[model samples]
Target: MSKGEETKTRILQQAAELFNQQGYAGASISDIMRVTGLQKGGIYNHFQSKDELAIQAFDYAIASISKHYRIAIRSKRHAIERLQALIAVFGSFAENPPIAGGCPLLNTAVESDDAHPALRERSQQAMNSWLNLIRRVIQTGIEKAEVQNNINPDEVATIIVATLEGAMMMSQLYNDTVYMQRAVNHLNHYIENNLKINGTS
Candidate 1:
């Protein structure tokens, strides 16, 4: 990449981490400067204002999370395996989150409520994308006869996302991996016993 492009990417990356760790209101331009080793002029050159930077940073954070999901489910063909891979990916975050603090979607969702329109919209889009992906996976499973035909993809996806996010919140709040593990284990059990075809699992 060109020098300016590289610097822009560096600024976005640093800002993403800072926002994930400190929230949009908590993280300052000075903090971003410190993280990126860039002056205000440098930052402003790339982004028009803090709001723009926060929006872009949120996008970067969600992209990083999506990348993690892509890597986790790359080789999994079946819907069950793909869903299991997602749970494993979330489980791994207890120790090492994709971004610095934790799930950006969860963090930003909590902080951006009525505070940041663009950022909150970005978070919502990320969540919608996640829910859509899960629903698609479950739909594919039904088509392939890997999952129960009567299963509702949208409802299952909502439950899975809700469970995973809640588990992540509890795990981070208590600084305990056991919470995440328990939630993941329960999700796995539900998937195996409830979603999958009787003989397929």
Candidate 2:
């Protein structure tokens, strides 16, 4: 990459970390600049304003989360195993957060509500993408007879998304992983009892 491209990427990476750690509202352009060791003019040369940087930072965070899930799912061959792998990814976050600030999607969603339109939309898109991926995986499991044919992929996806996000939030707030663990346990049970073929209960 060119020097300019490298600098821009560095700014975005630092901005993403700050946004995740503090928040869109809590984090300032000065804070980002301080973290990146860039002058104000250097930051402005890449991004027009702090709002633009916030949007880009949110995109970067979402992409990171998506990349992790993609890798986790790709490692599994079976459709059911892939779906389980996806859930396992979230479950493991309680023990090992992918990013230091916990789930970025949940963080942005909570903080950006009615505050930053661009950032909020970016977060929403990320969540929708995540839900759609889960839904597709469930659909594949059903088609392959690994999951029950009668299962509702959309509903299952919604529940999975909601439960995982909620768990992450609760875990972060309480500074405890128990809620996350319970959420994952329930999620695993749902998959085994509702989705799995052979009626394992």
Q: How close is each model in CA RMSD to the real structure?
A: 0.9, 1.8
Best by lDDT: 1
lDDT by residue (tens digit), candidate 1, 1-201: 999999998898889999989889998888988999988999999999999999998899888888989988888998899999999998898889978999999999999998788887888899999999899999999999999999999999999999989999999999998889998999999999999887773
On the 0 to 100 scale, the lDDT of residue 146 in model 1 is 97
TM-score of 2: 0.94
Model 1 CA deviation exceeding 4 Å by range? none
Reference-based lDDT, each prediction: 0.91, 0.85
